[model samples]
Target: MKTLSIDIETYSPIDLTRSGVYKYTESPDFQLLLFGYAVDEAEVHVVDLASGRKIPEDVLSALTNPLITKWAFNANFERICLSRYLREHYPDYFTSYGEDVATAKYLDPLGWKCTMVLSASLGLPLSLKAVGQALQLEEQKMEEGTRLIRKFSVPGLQGRVLPKDSPEDWELFKSYNRRDVEVEMEIRKALEPFFVSPNLWDEYRRDQDINDRGILVDRNFVESAMAMGKRAQEEITGRLQQLTGLANPRSPVQMKKWLFSKDHITHTLCKKERAHFIAHTSGDIHEALVLYSQAQKSSLAKYGAMADSACSDGRARGMFQFYGAARSGRWAGRRIQLQNLPRNSMEDLDLARKMVKDWDYEKLSFFYDEVTDVLSQLIRTAFIPRKGYKFIVSDFSAIEARVLSYMAGERWRMEVFAKDGDIYAASASAMFHVPVVKHGIHGDLRQKGKIAELALGYGGGEGALKAMGALDMGLTEEELKPLVTSWRATNPHIVDFWWKIDRAVKEAIENHRIMRVGTLTIFMQKGILFIELPSGRRLSYVGAAMKMGEKGYKTITYMGVGATKKWERIESYGPKFVENIVQAVSRDILCHGMKNLQDRYICGHVHDELIIECPEDTPVYEITETMAQMPDWMPGLVMRADGYETEYYRKE
Candidate 1:
């Protein structure tokens, strides 16, 4: 199939960084300056539309071609910008794919390839310049790009902003846009060998399709939530001013100085963690000061105002991102960040939601300390029941724990799961050697169990415990280490399982052979490898390889290693590989459950939880039982899934 790789220079009145693509392009002040393209990597072409050059007939035809692949770094930018361009230039074609087309039928997200995602897959930096250099492309585009964006971008004056229209500037804009496509093409070529595998490309395609079928949102919930957020925001502002004896106290830098220099909270009030904690706890004075400062940078006071610009129609659309967390293949959120929002604080969510909708700020503020907490919980409330249906939320119970044990062949751990799978409490009891009663009976034990399970799993030690806020949980430093040790010793089979999988993966990568642990197969190819699950999905390693480290033993590392490009490094098979295995197995379990729930229920999922919108009469217990069963091949590894049917998506 023929592909047209294109790039464009555009101007928008909205601040691109904070406002993002939606608001940036949505502005009435948005306009295209130059369009650049290459057809089959032939002679690269530039059309200086600003300088009055007509788009070539072929280029115009390619834009309309259903089969012609359009490529860009953030293809969303190109797709959206070009979409706007097409609708303005050729309305019939644009509207055909827009309001008229049945989204599931003609929406081929495959028509575009986001080189940003491709770069991410190869562990290349996000910027086109960085990606080009990483691929060792002959030409560099960085410095040229910086100057060109400034040269062609609409100039800003005090009261007016206008695009550059000089013929010379137009030529430069064309050149810059051309280089973007050039750099992108070069990166694609360099990574061609890696993408040669059909599975990888197929996965990439499916990811795009998933992005295309972005989730439908509840717009009314969004509006009501925003209204409540605004009212509380104003009250918080007034209270902060009263307490701090300063106007507009939300400034971080100013708040830091005030807290430390005046209030004498801490010397290091400038630090984020310290400042945030102190700011929240300092009551009216500290919060007021912080609120003033925050308003200066960008008003949290204008809480819900941003939502309308961020949201899509009555439904907040395009929330799910395919492979957004590429490392874990976890979906990321675009607008609301549904993945990381705070759990609902109110026990009776429906009542709290009603209060929020009615703009009852005084009641909510009375119960909740900061408006952010209330706002955070209310984000989930945005996901509501469609007219006649209620959301039946089901999730794999102790899924990560179950997957780890099953993959590791830890018979002892599996047996525990088989017999009532409350691994957190079970882990706590096992660690303390005391019988753990159910939640209400064993109150204090629950906290210990929850912390230990959350932190110590996947071979986490002291540092993990600290990350899980063990100290903040009123556990002393001495108790933390011993608790970790006790948990590790109690789950000895799980510890051994980690080592077992590590050895299997290291052997597979080093020997260029396959290693089997139970039903899982670890395969290596040219230092790039993945585990082939019994269900047949191969977990691709980010940077799969083996090398002799400081430990003097050959260690293996997987691909997509780090959270960011800076701190992420290939590390030892001992811990890093354990993390990989645990996550991979967890992903497989989700895939397994997803396959089962595909057509029988609404195929909606969030992290480990699946929200199946069902009728009131539906038997929830049977739903849990069905998810508990495993695939035929994963024998003797007893698993279970349990969750409540909530009117709104929330944790029970």
Candidate 2:
């Protein structure tokens, strides 16, 4: 297959982090500053069209070729920049647009391969500099060009392009741009051996396609949500001032002192206090540290940075990141953290929204003690329905848990999913060896069982249970260990699956052989371990090595223990990595389902849920059921999609 590496510098007045590509590149001021490219990995060339030089026919052809794949790091920018070029330069290509047309041909985000994705798939550190350092790629040796990059990226920042530009300035810009393309090509070559599945690439392309053709946005709902959020912000800031005698609630130093010294809260969420809290908490401080602990879960800046995502079209775009968490290949939230949003267990979200919006503080506080969940639901508010249309939401039922059961060959768990039994309650019953009657049927057994099944089964012990907020779910300290043990006893197959995978992976690493476990095929070579799925997609680990376990059994370990780039050290042979892979693979399955829905009904997807905006007369249930059906390739995996049609896109 022919491939062309490309890099372009473009300028836009629109804030990219908020309006996203579609809106950003569409700005009237938007103009490509420079274009750099390489064909078949040759000498990088610069094309300064701003110099009024006639563009070469071959370069033009390479730019528009549907089959000649384009390569760039952060390929989203490339796709959008090229798309702007195509639309402005050629209009006739739109006359007969097909369903599978590259999104850049239609809009933006469709026709490129992101080296960032390849880097993530290999679990390499993000950023071109980091990738270059990790792979030791030579072309990425340029020194501190941040200021140079910004000079070209920002229009009129360095100087307004003259009607006839200076040749020397243009040359520098193109060289810088060309270096990016060359670096991207080199990085992709370095990572080629990792071999991400073509199927996965196809799915990724489809994801970009979905993003290019963004869903219909509801201006009114978004406006209302922001208005209500503003009101809440005022109330919270006012309360904080009254409580702490501080003017700025957003001030970290002020809030930190207030929380620890003035309010007698003792606990803090910053990393500096991590060791202190860990030492003093006596290892069983869930209730005492819930607020501070939750704060630590994400960057404190994210709390205030949420406001920066607002867009001019009255629609907040890029709310959901497509494969943002490349290490696991999970979709992280960009403007809003949609994946980690609070689940709506409460029935009436409308009432909750109204309560928060109308300043009904007493009622809102009574229903949900804190505004975290309320604020989380506000993230969903960023997505709104079209004027005449509404959201037909359909989501897989207990998907990851069900996939765990199916993949583990757990008959009991499979049966629960197959029969429409409450998997959590059933898991509780299985663990506790009780009938698992309704919530009222047992004495605290219900909570214990529920928390145990959800938490401990995934190689989680008391700590994991606590991390999942089991204590906050209202399980007592005395019951934690017992619940953990009972969960291990109940889901024997899943527990076995963990060990089975560990053994298979360890053996593969030690022997340099390919081993199969159920639907997962383990491929080991050198220090890399790959778990290939039935869909031809693979989850890979780099530089995996074996270490001795407690009973002399082999345990797998890898470099880069934590999320930070500099934190490269071996940790534990834990379930965190495995869980990440399974979830990513599961998301792949859901993406396949979305592809299926594309043939009939699918407006877009928000996280794991699909929003199908169809005619009121359409059979929404059939759409939901069809989405729930698993591919023939994955027979053991049971699937179910649950949804409701709403006039507005709000949780039912």
Candidate 3:
């Protein structure tokens, strides 16, 4: 097959970060400035479209000719942007590409390839420069690329201002564009040794399709919600000011100093500090902190973002990034973060949403405890179904717990999942060795079980319990160690699995050997630590080696982007690896479910849930049943999905 490797410089007046590529390209002012391409292994070419050069007839024809493949890093941007450019410049070729089934406005995605997706699947960095450096490709991306992008690709001002330099700068920008194509071609070549599976590529297409078929946003609800939030915040700020006499109680430093001045209380107000306050504070101080919390919640940018993210079609798309969490293969949420949505617990959700939508601030203030919190809970409700359809929100029950138990050969836990049992209550019973039930015998002990299950799954101790909020749950300091001991004793097999796998991983790294624990194959090869999961996908740790840290213990180290999202050396241990395995497998299971229902209209998904668009009376149980079927590699792992239909997505 012929390949047209591409890299382009474009200008969009719209904020592409907030409104994704599809919406970004829809802008009237959007322009493809430079088009750089290479045919197969041929020399690269640059077409300065901004300076009024036309794309070659053959290159434009290749786009609509399905046999001529198109490749780019983050190909969604290139593909969608090209679709727009083609529609404007070469309608004949654009029309011939055929309409997309989901969003008929776009060209076909059949031959599009994303090198970023390829890098992510292999656990390489997502950035073009980073991937090139990691793979040590001889043809590196130009360092001047960033500066050139700011000069040329930035919105509004690029066409107006000629920089301090001249035609030479434009030439440099063109060279940068050409170099990007060269780097991208080299990357594709480097990755060809372990090219991503066709199935994974298909999954990438599905992701792009979903992003194109964005979920509907209730504009009325969103607009009213934003207004109500502002009003509520103003009221709260006024109250807080009257009570505290602080000039800016919303400022953390000001609030801390004010609290100290009030009662000589000086302490760190970080997570641990705030957790202590929630557990131990009282009187006026507690009221002040709670008010501050509400004000903080009110100021969440998501409410405003919902309005911005909604396209002209009244739908918000591109909230998901496929292969975003490189380790777990999970789709990370972007802009309005569905994966991290606040769980709605309002008893009368419809009433609360209606009040906010109606902009009845007084009704919300009187009926609800905190109007800002109400706005926070109502965020998910903003994502509504399209005009004629309803959303069927369904999710796997205790998927990670079930996967962990099944992987560890825990029969009792499997039985619980097989019967659709409440794992929290069952876990509490197992830990307490009592009839710990949900609102039944020793019901109070369920919290202990819940916290333990959350914290202690991967060889955690009392510190983990504290981190998981045992203290906030009102457990005594003395009871923490005992609780950890009891939970470990109860789930002896799980604990054993953690340490057994730990030993095997360390040995595999240290001796440069293969270690098989359960169906997982752990080995070190060519400076990369590979864990071949039962699903046949491998978790990669590039430039991996064991290093003894300042903590005086040797641990596994690898090259990765840290919390700050910069390339650096990352450290890990046995429990963390176990976490990666469980999450990756859980993510794979969700992917499998999504793929199984390919014909179904899956509009959006939270971590473990899939929100499908269907008719009001559609049989949702079949969706759940289909999702529960385990793949061939995942035998004896029982899974269950629960679902409910709604006009919009919710916690149900």
Candidate 4:
């Protein structure tokens, strides 16, 4: 058999949602109940493993055979689960497959293909059911699978419903397993035209390797932080109760009512509002508001997540999801979202971490005023390298800005990057027509320039400025309009690039023609709008069309996963498309860099940063220099990487 389409039903006492699949499978009670398979275009078959039936020997041989490709919806789940199964039941075959099962830790991903990744590559939904519905497949996923899974797979639910107890459900469960393989095969057939590139598959394999490598968690640090967070929360709750005399100060409704009744404050007690009230009010009200804001800091929850998802070896796996952001094809964070970890700005992070690990609450409180906030800032430190190794954390410097400049032919922005100069100050200088420095003459304008650069990059105007907190940064509402105009006026090429892309997209959809904007190519293929990036990776827009807007201009629209995460038709324009292109290119660059450094023990990555677990003697510049090397697709794009060596992971 050239291809093996498979699906599995697993039973585990571990909470798969809370702990990741790696930890879930580590449970001794974990069992692969049903193994369903279809070899090539043959009839689907279900091997009831839970009832003592064994998988066919030929099919089992095909699993370890590198020539035979295995296909599944979320293939990672199947590949990992089957790896455990093979090692346990078919030890000889598992060990003789060419790689050491002990050190390699799982099945080689080179022989596996994920249909979920394929669906995502086409800008389709990631779920099996959603993709089947989106593709209008003849064999759709069974809706009854969820109920049957809950009945049999889950443990401690009314004393574990077994096939002996519910024979009818058992038959349906086997059918559900068989139908999943059929649906997966149908998805592959439907998406056969848009074949996923080998490079992308190679990148997916690298992602799997990184996930399997798993980052070591500082168990002592995580446990201490969690315990400290609990105690700190109790103390803060008691203080708020004593001061406000409210039933629950943590409750927003209760706090808002109390604040309005006592202090005449009527605004919502969100982060910004709480800060405002604390600054304005005095005495117990001020103290209580400050305490309330401190209590609301949820960064410490990451510690709990790290603790939960960590495997028996004290490493967290499956934290990054490939193509999680389908629009830009950026990897999304799973279980313990390393993507959005709170920035650590504490001057004495090492001291605070040491105190917490020592469980010295008194010293910690003495050294830090807001102890809970300290814990929040120390969250990143929980991910530590294993003994005898250090984490060499490196990241591209202002990657998005550099990529936008390179693509738009913004010369001065490129110049800034080339010289390793400050883009924020350069942008401010260009916009205001004055020499702007970070802490020198007219340095105040740098903040305005920084905010303007961030907000106005994607064709944002006054509203974007406000959303970026311009008013809080001391910029007036009147200044936002002029700042946007000034930014656009200074970066004329970028503005032109935006409209050029906009016009190209409009032409591609309306005229049914291929259009080129700068180094990017836009075309419509079978109702899908493909924007081919310089890296040769295409960003897809499904069901693309153009309609006359109320403003008398043609507005481009496409079917995509929207803000609410439902598949629907969404409107788009040039600047937005430019944003996607630039970010996607940045992602490609990151993947390229990771490929360059693949020989190193790269544990994990967060956005543009790569966290490498290496010997303490490894030079930090070696990793940074390799990452800064530009790809062959874009010759003139100036790239720079900066890094720091740390025993534990942290934002430097």
Candidate 5:
């Protein structure tokens, strides 16, 4: 067979939603219930494995054959599940390829194609049901599948009804399984014209390899942190109860009522509001508010996630989702979200971690006033390097800023980068006509320059400045408008770039003509707007059109997953498109770096940073230098990487 489109139904005692497919399949009770397949758009077939039906020899061989391509929606799940199924059922077929069933990784991703990834590439929904509806497919996935899955697949649901117990539902479940394969095949055919490029497939393979490799987790550290967090929560709750006399001080409504009745503080208990009130209040009120804020830190729950998702080997797999960010095609954190882990700013993280791991709660409390906050900060330390190996954590320095400068042709900014000068200082020097330094002459202006650089690079205004915490940084409301104007005036080229992109998008949609702005190529094709990046990957905007916006001006709009995550027509502008393009390009540059370092043992990556497990002797500078190399497409772009070696993961 040249190609196989497959789907399967599985039953596992493990919680698949809490634990990823790798950990889910590790359960001894995991069973493959139904296997559906179609060979090259031929007749579809279903083997009721749970009903004791056996798959044909030819079909089984095709699964392990590298020459035959495999297609599925969310192919990673199918590939990983089938890998285990084969090892348990037909070991010879799995081992015939010289792979050890006991230690082999999932089936080679090279031979697999994911329809979900294809849909995501076109800015389509990632779910099979959503994609089927989004595409208006004739063979949509069966809605009855969910109820059937709950009845049969899940454990502890009324003694786990079997096929014999519910014959009709079992037959319907088989049909549901068959229909999924049919829908996946239809999706493949519909998306054939916009097939994922070979280079992207290579990148997908790399992502799969990283996920399969997994990251070592310190189980003892995670468990100890969880226990300490529980104790901290109890202590804080008790203190709040004793001071406020509230039955449930943790409840925001109760706390708000208590604050108003006792201290006459009439405001929401948000982080900023709490900080504001804390500064104005005194005595027991201030102490209670501080305790409440410390108790509100929920990041310590990540330790629980790590503990749940870790495999028997003590490694957490499937933490990163490839192409999870539909707009920018960036990887998204899955089970234990490493992307938003609380930053570790403690001076002695090693000592604190050791104390916690040793379960010395008293000592920890003595050193740290807020034990819950400390536990939140220690979440990153839960990911440790393997024995005899150290972590080389490297990431690009100001990747988005550098990319924005290169794309906008901001010469002064680029010059600052080339000379290794501080952009924030250079921006202050350019905007205010003063030589700004980090902690030297005119250093106070550096904060303004820093805020402006962050908020105004994408055509932000006074509102963006406020959202970036300009006021919290001690900038007045009156200064906000002037800062926005000064930043825009100083970087005329970047402002022009925004408008150029805006006009290009409008022209592409209104006139149905191709438009070029800088290194980007925009065009409309079959109701889709495509912006081809310098890396040759096109960002697709579905159902491109122009509409009269709320501001009484014609705005470019397209069908996409909007703020509510529903498929709808959303409005856009020049600066917003610039943000998307800049972020997308930045993601490509990161992928390029990962490609360069593919030979190394890359355990995980979060945004611009890569965590590599290597020998203690590995030179940190070499990894950083290699990651700093620029791609040929962006020749004049200046790039830099900063990294450090650590025994455990942490932010530098």
Candidate 6:
């Protein structure tokens, strides 16, 4: 057989939502209940492994045959699950991945193809049923998938009666499995024309290997941090109760009533509403608000997730989701949500880490206001290097800003990056026509430049400044509009770039032809608007069209995931499109850096930073030099990297 399309129903007592599939499958109770397959687009077959039915010898051999390609939706699930199934039922057919057969991990991902990855490349839905509906495919996944899996795929409980699976339901379950393979096959065929390049597939393989290798987490720190968080919650909740005399100070209804009693101001007790009420209230009410804010912060829960999600080997796998940002093709954090991790700010982070690892709750309380807050800051320390290894954490400096300058032909901004000068200082110098330096002469002006650079980069104005926490950064209510104006006036080329992109996109979508704006190639094809980046990968806008928007101005409309996270028709203008192009190109640059170093090291990469774990003797400068090497695709685009060596991951 040239190809095998497969899907399997699995059972595991472990909570798959909290712990990832890797930890879930490692459970002793884990097992495969059903296996469905189609060979070379032939008739689909259901192998009821739970009922003792076996896969044929030829197909069993095909699982190990590198010549035959294997296809699946979310291929990682099937590959990892099937590896365990093979080791248990067909050891002879299972290929050894490590030095010893008994110690082997899982099947190699060399010959595997994921239809989900292909769908993401086309900017399609990640779900099988959703993709089928979106593509209007002939064979669709069965709608009863969840019901059947919940009934047959979970373990039986003692004395907990469940409805017996009648003969009809059993047959239906088998058909559900069979239909899944057919739907996956159909999706594979439908998306073949938009296939991701082999280079991208190679990157996917590296992503998988990094996930499979997992990251070593300090279990002692994780567990202690969770315990300290629980204590802090109890103490804060108790303090609030004692101060307010409310039954539960955290309850919105009770807190609202209590606040009204103190200040005669009644409002909704949600986070924003409460903050507004506090800003207007005084004395005990304000104290209560501070207490409530302290109690409601959620940073400690991440440590709990890390403690629970860690595998038996004390490593956390499946923490990064490849192509998680389908639009920009960037990875998103899975378990513990590392992408949104809290920044560390304690005076002596190492001492705090030691105290947490030592489980010295008294010391933790003495040095920290909220023990839970300390625990939250200590999340980075939870990811420790393996024995005899140190982490070389390196990342590009102002990568997005640099790419924006290169694409917009902002010469002065490019020179700032090239000269290794602080962009914020350069921006302040430009906006005020005076010499500026970070924390030096004209240092106070740096705040304006910083806020402007952040808020006005993508055609944002006064509103974006406020949204980006300008007021919190010591800017006044009257300063926002001026900040936006001054920044835009100084960076005229970047502002002009936005409108040019808008014009080119409108022209392309109207005429259904290719148009060039700056370094970007824009075209409309088969109801999709494709923006080709410098890396040769395109960003797709599904169902492209032009419509009069807001005061008779024209705008581009396309189907995309909106703020509500539902796939719907959305609107975009020039600056938003530029944002996408810049981010996508930035992702490609990170990919190039990772590709260059994946052979030697690359434990995990978050945002723009790469975490490398190697021997204590490994030079951090060498890793920094490797990351600084510019890719050939964007020649003249200068790149710089900064890093430091640490026994654990933390910003230096």
- Clashes found in each candidate (C-alpha, N, C closer than 3 A): 23, 0, 0, 0, 0, 0
lDDT (C-alpha, whole model) for all candidates: 0.63, 0.65, 0.83, 0.89, 0.89, 0.83
Q: State the number of backbone clashes in model 6.
A: 0
Model 1 C-alpha lDDT per residue in residues 349-381, reported as the tens digit of each score: 777777677767778778766655556666666
lDDT of 4 by residue, 496-552 (tens): 999999999988888888898878889998889999988888899989998676789
Provide TM-scores for the models: 0.78, 0.83, 0.94, 0.98, 0.98, 0.95
| Residue 390 local lDDT, model 1 | 72
Model 3 stretches with alpha carbons more than 4 Å out: 95-102, 156-159, 162-165, 270-287
Q: Point out the higher-scoring one by lDDT: 2 or 6.
A: 6
Per-residue CA lDDT of candidate 3, range 299-391, in tens? Answer: 357878788788788888778888999888889888878888788888889999888788788888998887787788888898887778898
Error of 4 at 100 (Å): 8.6
Model 2 CA deviation exceeding 4 Å by range: 90-111, 155-170, 224-228, 235-244, 247-265, 269-316, 342-379, 547-555, 565-567, 570-574, 600-603
- Reference-based lDDT, residue 456, model 3: 89
lDDT of 2 by residue, 509-592 (tens): 888878888877887754667777777767667677887766786567765436564736454453665576568767877878
Q: What's model 4's TM-score?
A: 0.98
Scanning candidate 2 in windows of ten residues, the lowest lDDT window is 294-303
Clashing pairs in 3: none
* Candidate 5: regions farther than 4 A off: 95-105, 263-267
Candidate 6 off by > 4 Å: 96-103, 156-165, 264-283, 548-553
- Model 4 has an lDDT value of 0.89
TM-score quality measure for candidate 5: 0.98
